[model samples]
Target: MVSCKNVFLTLTLVVIASNQCECGVYSLIRDLLQWNVAGIPIIHKTVKWDFDPEVSQKRREQFFELHGYRAGKYLERIGLGIDGKQRERAYQHAIRDQGKLQGLSILQP
Candidate 1:
């Protein structure tokens, strides 16, 4: 009793719906890893930084603030995301370690 055209339309709709569902799941997983594990958002565009330390530092902080750290405490407050302060401490520690390895005196903040 079903017409061929009706069957084809149903099949097309089902395929599209399934594809959208799959895409949503993939996006959720990707966001979890990016923001929660890496403490960084998805950078959609090319970002440039200045060679000057002060300018670079300001730019970096602004970037973090604008994109936000750990999805702005949504995941972080729930303890599911990486803590921004902890990430900063790790960064500072790495800088110190690098300075020691290179035998250079790195200025600390």
Candidate 2:
């Protein structure tokens, strides 16, 4: 029988991996693209522009610790600015990068 510790470790890894993204980055990209195509406002003043660097750094570290280098680069590439519409490209890149790091073969519909 497998040891409890081994099972716990496996479960922990699975949980950590699942925290990377929701519905995959490709899907997010597609959504953003569609939103743009539809002439919907992509950027707004309501969006938080000044997320603390310390918090972002902590989150980035957590992402790296959980997903490793490739994933970390994905987030780094996206950046944390409050430029709403202007930041789409970076956000998309980060999402794509994160997807790659997580071993997710998801495609945008």
Candidate 3:
């Protein structure tokens, strides 16, 4: 027989632990943006923008479509997320790569 209180505690702990991963989506984005603003060069330490560069071209195309859609729809207020080339480059090391693949199949053709 499980107590309701215990169940609630377990669920709460699970959610907390899940969010405490080494690097979460929120914190990762924040750090990436910070690095972009600071002009620091990325060395693939924590954030990884492109998980797999070997994916099919069709999948690569989806990234392009979603990139545009998401920028206009969600990131319009965030200033189009982390700019690869820096929106202004106010710092010397601004516009870090942040583990993004230099090129993808979609860009080839």
Which one is best on TM-score?
A: 2
**Candidate 2: lDDT of 96?**
70
Off by over 4 Å in 3: 21-109
- lDDT for each residue of candidate 1 in 30-103, tens digit (9 for 90 to 100): 55545665567545457886666578888778867765774553443344335557666656667766856444
Give the clashing pairs for model 3: 39-93, 39-94
TM-scores vs. true structure, each candidate: 0.19, 0.21, 0.19
List candidate 2 stretches off by more than 4 Å. 1-50, 72-109
Superposing all C-alpha atoms, what RMSD in Å does each candidate have to the true structure?
Answer: 18.3, 29.6, 23.1
Residues 1-109 of candidate 3: C-alpha lDDT, one tens digit per residue = 9998897566555545556565565456545544664456655558748666667777757866775644553354354346674445423222453333442333444
TM-score of 1: 0.19
Q: Show how many residue pairs clash in every candidate, following the order shown.
A: 0, 0, 2
Q: How well does candidate 3 score on lDDT at residue 51?
A: 67
By summed lDDT, the worst window of 10 consecutive residues in model 3 runs over: 90-99
Q: Per TM-score, what order, best first?
A: 2, 1, 3
Cα error of candidate 2 at position 38, Å: 21
Candidate number that wins on lDDT, 2 or 3: 2
lDDT of 3 at 9: 67
lDDT of each: 0.60, 0.61, 0.53
